[model samples]
Target chain A: MALLEVTNLSITFGGLRAVDNFNLTMEKGELYGLIGPNGAGKTTVFNLLTGVYKADEGLIKLDGLDITGHRTAEIDRDGIARTFQNIRLFKDLPVIDNVKVGLHNQFNYSTAESMLHCGRYHKVEKEMDEEAMKLLGVFDLDKERDYLSANLPYGKQRKLEIARAMATKPKLLLLDEPAAGMNPNETAELMETIQLIRDKFDMTILLIEHDMKLVSGICEKLTVLNFGRILAHGDTKDVLANPEVIKAYIGE
Target chain B: MRKTQKKTLITYAIVIIAYIILEIFMKAGMMSSHLKGLLVPMVYYAIAAVALNLCVGILGELSLGHAGFMCVGAFSSAIVSQLLSGAIPDALRFILALIIGVVISALFGMLIGIPVLRLNGDYLAIVTLAFGEIIKNILNSIYLGVDSAGVHLSLKSQMALGLADDGKVLINGAMGITGTPQDSNFTIAIVVLLISLFIVQNMIDSRDGRAIMSIRDNRIASESVGINITKYKMTGFVVSAAIAGAAGVLFSHNIATMQATSQYFGYNVSIMILVYVVLGGIGNIRGSVIAACILYLLPELLRGLNKYRMLIYSIVLIVMMIINWSPALRDKRDKLRKKLMKGAGHGAA
Candidate 1:
């Protein structure tokens, strides 16, 4: 069974069909890439999947569970975690806490316990710190764990966000233009991290990107979106070579 | 973790040292009775400021109805203490009142938070502002008494209550509750303040605190990461309200008479508490404490200035703002501190 299945997903903003008849299926541990030109509604599709936007008509199933129209947190608990196109780390909180917030549901302590610092609070907090530190280690953010997330340099901020998302322990991870503003060197490093993450965590990944290098290097399957419609869908090499997909990217 | 622990310890130390010094001054007869009278109010105001900071700074919600929570605490606890005066021992009665106050206000917090939190920014602020005034007005018009006939409540005149001969009026409309037991003292107020500090600081360092703050930072990201936004927001808001209620308990118990009035539990008081939160450096709990103490005492201390009192206060407020927030002023202060440290090092050498 597919980890995530979206059938006939569509949304409209007034008369404009922002995302129309979008269908996607990802098998367990598949690395999928979604690429498109500007205004291609790629992020809109991610929003629909994450429950940031309610789909006008669609069926979203996660791990055989019908999760259509569930709220973002509900969908996340049902096993889908995502990073934003514009990096959204808890800016005022420390780097470790950003991940610890992601680790929130996995741990347990009541409001009273947290307030009074009694009961299971100490043990749970220590465990959270350890788990967060280990995740930070994976992203090489351990050295900067105590720094406020807003203070980190751009590349590291992106990595911290991904680490925070990964901390949620989701089965399906969505990366919306994870390498959006990176130069070649950082983009290459990010590509390696993405592959490493898939292998290490056995994650089913879907990412939107304009960076062809990172996309071609890491994505096994590709789906091209243009003006809210799928232009091509196949293995990465075949989809990229398709004349229609190429035309949407460069020009006719 | 160690850094935060040390910082919290410093905050505790500051409160403790201030308490000790004030005690010494009082024992030495250096404090006027007027100054002594101001002590409990100052502490409670500081406590209220800390509570407001929890909501405004940490939860990232602007609540203009904090004084309403305080008002709820004050009245409910006062009534409980009054009714239970002889049934429970005095200390125990006060403790029960405090607990009841916190719990009742927390309930009010959750009730108000449910609908109010759905709105954001200015809308939330406006609604809370209305709620605060509404609470005060409702309390003002209530007349409550108890007798062998169970309990009597009236929105009309006290005569309408038609209580039994031995009936005791707990709350009189407009006049408010008179003869509330003066169970609160400076020491008790300070102790409550310390507990508030402990709860807020500990919660901020814990996992749930991180979740609440994450919502404050970004709602969408927090939700995507499986942090329940509504639950955490309510948690922060309600806890903050409960603490404000504790301060209210202190307030009612310290006063000879507790009244629901614009002077005490109005929008102005809420805004004043907010000023403490902002001037103390919002999200800085210790800063709230210090700001509340100094700002609350300033006008009282300058009463001798008479006509110039408020004028001086306006200047102080402006100075505090610049000192705390102005980038240029902060840079200069930082440089000065660094130089002072360098000079101290040279002297040691």
Candidate 2:
């Protein structure tokens, strides 16, 4: 069985079909790419899958469980985590606290424990902080833990988002436009970070990126979307070689 | 683990020593009466201000009827304490009275928060303002004053629900409760203030507090996160309402002639409490406490201005807003603040 499945999923906003009849399937441990020209509904699929927008039509199942309408926090707890297309870090929070916010899902202390600073609270907080620091270390962001997320350089902010999402301990990680405003050097560094994190964390990743070079380099499987529909899907080379995707990009 | 635990233990030891010293000074006459008096309004208003902070700052919802909740707390405690002047132990009686006050106010909060928490902006302001008036009218309709029998007969009775002695307040209508016992003191007030501070601080730092901010920052984002915005908003509302209620009890019980005449728990009181939060730079707990002190003192400072005091205050508030919101000035202030904290943190380290 597929690890994640979307069947005929459609979402509309009062006459504007933001996403229509979207469908895909993913295997466990796959690193996949989703690509489209601007306004091609790539990000909308992410929104729908993450439960930001309700699907007006069709089904989304993650590991045999229907997640079409799970709450975003619930979705995160259920082994699925995603970064936003536009960076949505809790901009004012310290980088460590931003990651801690993700770890809020994993906390097991009571209010009483916190108030009295009980043994359980301290123990849980210590364990969680160490785990969060380990995640940050993977992204080479442990040094910047005290910095406010908004103050980070553009590339570091993207890394912070990934570091944050990883704190959720997701089984399937989704990164949206992770290399948006990077120079080649930063993008090249990001490529290694993403691959390293995938290997270290042992999680499947689905990414939507505009940079074709990054897409072609990292993705083993790919899906191409256009105007609310899937234009192509399958192995990265086949999806890229598909006539419809070629036509869509050529016409653009 | 070894180094950090040792450092934290030393830090905690210092904090405990400081706390003990402060408590000793407070209990002794080491602090001046003027400072003590100043702290009275500070603690009282802080209780109400934190509630306002929850509704106005954290939940990012507006309510102009906060004073009405305070009114509920004050009267509830006043009546209970007055009626029970001889029935219970000195300490336990007062505790019961305060509890009654908090519970009553929480009920009022739940009643108001259910409908009003959903309304945002000016619409919420109007609803809350009207709710305050309705409470005032209801209070006014049931008078409590000296009667022909020389017994205090208020429109409402001090009698516990069904306990008898319909001695009359709603058992007399708008004369208002007279001859009520005034038993609240600095000790009681400060203890309540500390509890209020503890609750407000805990809520602010907890996941629930973050959830409240999440609700304010982005409604859709918060809901998508399974935050149950309504529950968290109501939590802030009720907790704040209960604190305000406790303040009301303390106020009514503190002063013998605590009057709610004309505009007692009126719009101005609500605005005054809200100003405490806004002036402190919304969302800053320490800032709220400071704001309460300065704003409470502003009126006394205006005593020399006599009639012009309010005018000066109004101007000061407006000028403060101009200074605060100007991007360039705010950025400069942030830089200065960060520099100071860095210096302080380093020194502490």
Candidate 3:
């Protein structure tokens, strides 16, 4: 069975269909790319998948569990984690603390224990610190772990966000425009980090991007979307070469 | 030790050392009675300020109803101490009263938090403001007494209570509760303040504290990451209210009369606590302690200056705000610190 399966996912805003009859299936450990022109319902699809918005109609299944119309937190607990396009982070917190917040459910202690710093509180906190540092080390953020997240350089901030997402231990990860504002060098580094995340954490990733270099460099399967409909779907090389997909990118 | 732990330890040490110095002064008769009388009140207000900071600074919610929670604690503990007054030993009765006060306040926190926490920003603040006023009004009109016929309550005149001759009036409408045991002292107040600081500081360094702060930072991202928003918000708010209630207990026991008055539990008092949280530097627990102490004591200390007292107070408020917040000033201060440190390093070399 596939790690994620969606059938006929649809949503409408007023008279316009934001996402219409969108269907997707992904196997475990796949590096999938979702590409489209601006406002082709790509982020809307992400919102629906993560339960930010209830789908007008659809069946969303992850690891064979039907998770349609669940709340965002519930869907995350069911194993889909994502990064935002605008890079939402706990800016006042230290870098490692941001990831520890992501690991909230994994290590549990009662409110009383937390307030008093007794019982399992110390043990769990130490474990969380070690684990968060380990994840930060992967992104090369361990040294800057004590710095408030807002103070990090832009490229490092993006990496920290991805690190925070990985702390949740999700089965499938979603990256929304991972290289939205990066220089070529940073974009190249992000591409390597995306691949490293997949290889090291055994993560399955689906990312949306406008940067063709990063997209073509890493994505194995490609799906081109335009006007909320699939323009082309196939292996990366074949889909990129399709005249229909090319037309959608640079109109006829 | 971690940086946060070291900072927390320093806060504790400061409070303890101050307590010892004050005790020595009081015992040696070096402090005036008028000045000494303000001690417990000062500490309790500091405790309330700490609680408000947790709600406003850490949870990132603006609340103007904390005085209502404090009112709840004060009235409830007063009634308990009045009823239990001769039935138990003084110390034990006070402890029980404090416990009951805290529990009841926490329950009220949970109840009020359910509806108030749903609103955001100004709406939340407005609703809480209304809540504080409502609690004060309700408590003002209530007349409660205990007798062999169990407890008697009346919103009408105290006479409408129709208590038996032996019945003791716990609360007499607007007159409020009087003759309650005075069980609070400076030592107890300082102890409670330190404990409140410890709890809030520890919680901030824990997973739950991180969750609360994450919600404050980005609600949607926290939700996307599987953090339960309502649960965490409620947790921070209720704990904050509970701590305020503890402060209330200290307040009621420190005075001879416990009245639900606008002077004590009104919107202005709530705003005053917020000022402490803001002026102390939001999200800075130790700052709350120091701010509450200095700001609360300042007016009284300047009593000899009478007319100019408030003027100086307002000027100090403005100065503290700039020192804590103005970015240009902060940059300059940071540079000055670096320069001083560099000189010290050269001297050591």
How high is each candidate's TM-score? 0.97, 0.84, 0.98
Against the correct fold, how does model 1 do in TM-score? 0.97
Give the Cα lDDT of each candidate: 0.93, 0.75, 0.92
> Which is the better candidate, 1 or 2, if ranked by TM-score?
1
Note the residue pairs that clash in candidate 1: none
DockQ for model 2 equals: 0.25
Q: C-alpha displacement of B135 in model 2, angstroms?
A: 3.1
Residue-wise lDDT of candidate 3 within A1-252, one digit each (tens)? Answer: 999999999999999998889999999999999999998989998999999999999899999999998999999899999999999999999998999999998999999998999999989999999999999989999999999999999999999999999999999999999898999999989999998999999899999999998888999998888888878887999999999988888889
User: Model 3 chain B: which ten-residue window has the lowest total lDDT?
Assistant: B116-125
Best candidate, TM-score: 3
User: Best to worst by lDDT, what's the order?
Assistant: 1, 3, 2
lDDT for A69 in candidate 1 is: 89
- For each candidate, report its DockQ versus the true two-chain complex: 0.88, 0.25, 0.89
Query: Candidate 1: what lDDT?
Result: 0.93
The lowest-lDDT stretch of 10 consecutive residues in candidate 3 chain A is: A225-234
Each candidate structure's count of clashing pairs: 0, 22, 0
List the candidate 3 regions with Cα displacement exceeding 4 Å: B119-121, B334-349
